[model samples]
Target: MTMQNPVRPLLTPLLAALVLAGCATAPPSLDKALPQTPAAFSEGGVPWTTAAPAEAQARGEWWKAFGDAQLDALVERAERGSTSIQVAAARLAQARAVLGATDANRALQVGLGAGASREAQRGLGVAPNTVLSAGAQLSYELDLFGRLAKASDAAALDVRSREALLRSTRLLVQAQIAQSYFALRALDAEQTLVHGTVEAYRDTLRLTERRYAAGDVAELDLVRVRSEVAATESEALALERQRAQLEHAIALLAGEPASGFRIAADDWRATPPQVPAGVPSTVLARRPDVSAAQSALLAAQARVGVAQAAWFPNLALTASGGFASSELSELFRSSARAWGIGALLSLPLLDGGRREAGVANARAELDAALAGYREQVLVAFKDVEDELAALRLLARQGDAQGQAVDAAARATTLSETRYRNGLVSQLELLDARRSELRNRREALQVRSAQYQSTVRLIRALGGGWGEAA
Candidate 1:
């Protein structure tokens, strides 16, 4: 009578188990783990039409909007050379490699092995026998509980997070370069104004000295005029020092040595561009930080699924085919060949709560990731509001400052005429000149602030500005 194979009886039951496990659903996505987005920003005025997701869009040369060729060049150089960007890119590559490794777990693994051995029974005084073996072994773990799939998903999300971080780093470097360049230019303008004032003061001091020598003015008046010239000259020197410091900062941002880099003195002429703050929801898409945080949260969620899957049984299939012979010449002969195949299903009965602790840890990580994502979203909103308010208030301040500068200039001109005609004291003329200088410097400061705010806003909005198509 023919006997049935013993392992064949278990195949039907194992196949049924596999089918049941196949119906198991994957972990739910955490995409909605956020508060409701406001329709309009508190400081951004009314919301305009919502734009398509800007994260997927290329952030074309937003610096070009300022119409400054120098700024464009500096930002481009910084993007290419910034070390922060390089670090983030390296992290992205690592995450991608991890993903490739995680995916490899789902594919069959094959390995070739060879061995030789000699055996002897010492106590029996038997002769030694030589053995030689060569084989290829294969193994594949069936994803019966979705553990491998969830791990792969987590790895992929990690790659996405790293990619977003790289983009964020690039945007930050670009913005820093632009802001520093503009600040250096503003200082140049201020230094020029101070130097011109110093020259004017020097001329006045010469006139005062001549008048004192002719006995037409007191020695006290001449002494005061000389002191004013010295003070104004000192102020010009201080401004020069500040401009040098700013130039050094710009060089560092551009990835160049401060000792060798130089920016020639130029007029502050780059106009701050008007960046439109579209509907508040668009910030979620545009901001790379926000995107990175969201990806982290999803990855953490997938890890939780992976941890939970640990409670289920693991299934693996292994196979090996080989040639073995005592003599090397007969190793590959048909009679020396061997082959084996196996399927293993294992479930741990006890592990001192290790699996439970793993689940707990993964869940806690998920909670932390969720909290981080929410905080990032809130901070992004706050950043947009802060820059919008700064731009608005600075514009008004600039207008008022312009009027003050105009009035101060008129006062200085009148004071000069009165002093020359001996109708006003030398002290009054000096006060008017100081006021004019202060107003001009303040105006330049307001302009600088506007430019810096524009760059910051672009960064907050993920480094670009344009109407949505």
Candidate 2:
């Protein structure tokens, strides 16, 4: 008669459960947790033309749309040289290595050992004897509960999260460089305008002095013109100071020493890239931050599975084969050969609520990750909406500003002509000139804002490198 193992009945149910756990499921689809989004954005974006073939493939270097070669070179250099990018890359590499190590965990593990020992048995009246031994051991954790597998899956998701975060960091660095570069250019134009105004004021001052000397105008006119020239020159100096600061900021972003870096005065003419008529669904996928959050949530789910796995029994098999002998040379001899194999089954009878606490902690972490992911999605939608509204409103403001500048220019021309014909007072002519300068400067500011907003919107939509339309 065949005899059955006494524990067979008790183990049957656990073995069945372990088999069921092998079919572990991953986290649910992100769609179920995502907040509601509108089909169309509230603000219509800037009128952007369709991209050319070359432009469509430019990727993260969206600054190239501005057609500035210097900016392209700067962004490229930053991508390679910035410490921020380097740090993020290092983290991504570390996550990959961790995942690789975790994957390797789901395999047989072996260890080898050799040892020699001598023992003296004075009480037993035996002579001292020496023994030598050599052995190789093998052990494998039978992942019947899918515990190790779930841990590995969690690690893999972590790698994906890090990868997305790295991409997000790279996009942020590029956007910062573009915005700074554009701002510097705007300041350059402003300085040029200031310099011209200063020179024109100085020339007027000299003419007024001569006219006063010849009794063609009063001393008050010369004093007033001199004051205007002084103030204009002072404004030019301040503008140059601001330009230097912006240049320094750009150099730092490019990972260069500010003292050794300089961006010469250049024109700003970057046309905004086209916002493709894609809906919110695509944007969610393209945004790296959102992707990163989703990966984190998935990782959390995997961890919860790992924790739940602890409730199941653990199974391990271990084996060792070796030889032993009084003489080191005979350690591998057949006469001294020995081998052993064993299996272990562990079940938690009591753990003072540790396992339950672990499950609770894991569940809490999953909840937190889910909440965090939802927050990021909401923030992403808001970011896109905010930028669209800004661009739309800025476009309207720019149009009005342009009209104001044109009117001021016409008013200045008429006032100058009337002053030359002795039909307008010097105060009236000076006020008209200042108004034109102020209006022109304001218009340039509005244009700069438009370029900045365009860059912001591109970043909000996720850099051109991703699935962004």
Candidate 3:
């Protein structure tokens, strides 16, 4: 007797053609370095530059840049306590696990199974028997078209990108915590200033009231002094509220309940950290966000190779072995062993443009990633330039404002002397007092702005806390 098969002959030539076609397409070479002349450098602004003392602080502990023990402790606590950082770390671990899974696919998969059964004899005289079977199977892809390699590469890149994302989250958390801490300190300073001003006004008001009672000054003068006292008291109250809000913000960043955490009221004498000069090219690597973007680009590039690889055939090797025995004791015996091996060829000969669309989409994604990477570099440059300009302009403004404050102080002293000699009215003396107060407040604001600008510069230069004077 002869048997005939229809499907076997039909499948042979198609599989052969797929294998032949796959061999024709070459594997792509992935360049680790980005293309020269990144899109970031094309647009002109302030040439990105860093300026700092030649002897710079270590980068490993950039937070020490501010040289504040309290700040250093706060940052370290925030890093450990932050829920957002934990989430990012978990995501990175998940990505690495996924990479491991993909890598496992590139190697052979082996499995073992076992089964046992007992049966009674039928009326037809079949014998009662216990049956036992054990089996082993193995399967693996040959990766003849580099498809597995590309997929594993893409997964690895994704893992790296997620790791970079975690780093970016850490950097963001550090900066936010520091800024909030500084803001809280600034508010504390402002409150102290307001309270002192209130005390001075209270003293002045008491003197005016006494003088008015003695018929030495008008009642209107006492009322004016009382009003200044009220205004300063109001500002002090507002500052207390503002400081509370800053405290709450800091607590949230530190992953603690606002009620559970409190910052001690230290005098706001801690100076902004000194910024270090980093190389322009180094900025691209130092900024966590930019590094994340670059990692994403690398991942996307790897995906392109994966998508392209799909256009080729998949080659696989399959093998299976099993043992069977009618008697339980015979299972896994030498006579029961068996094994076989075969190769498989698979190809997507025709789809409704699906494979082509995949390739196109992957290419588009690569383009987008490259563009985003370039954009990040450009933004990094702009941030540095903006801080540089701000530092320069603020220093000049601070100098001029200091001069104005000094002149107002002198004018206040002269006016006080004039009033004592009856050369000026009480109103003129009040006017001079008010002018000096306004000048002093403005000067304080200028100083705060200059300090904050320096802080911005330090962050832009990537850590190195400034020393306190």
Best-performing candidate as measured by TM-score: 1
Candidate 3: tens digits of C-alpha lDDT, residues 180-233 = 877777777777777877776787787778788999888888888888888878
From the highest lDDT down, the ranking of the candidates is 1, 2, 3
Off by over 4 Å in 2: 1-30, 45-60, 279-281, 465-468
lDDT of 1 by residue, 153-190 (tens): 99999998998898898888888888888888888898
Clashes of each: 0, 0, 7
Q: In model 2, where is the ten-residue run with the lowest total lDDT? A: 48-57
Q: Native-vs-model 1 lDDT?
A: 0.85
lDDT of 1 at 317: 100
What's the TM-score of each model vs. the native?
Answer: 0.92, 0.90, 0.85
Question: Candidate 2 residues 320-369, lDDT tens each?
Answer: 99988999778777999999999998877579999889989998999899
Ranking by TM-score: 1, 2, 3
TM-score, prediction 3: 0.85
Q: Candidate 1 or 2, higher TM-score?
A: 1
Clashes of 3: 7
Question: RMSD to native for every prediction?
Answer: 3.9, 4.3, 5.3
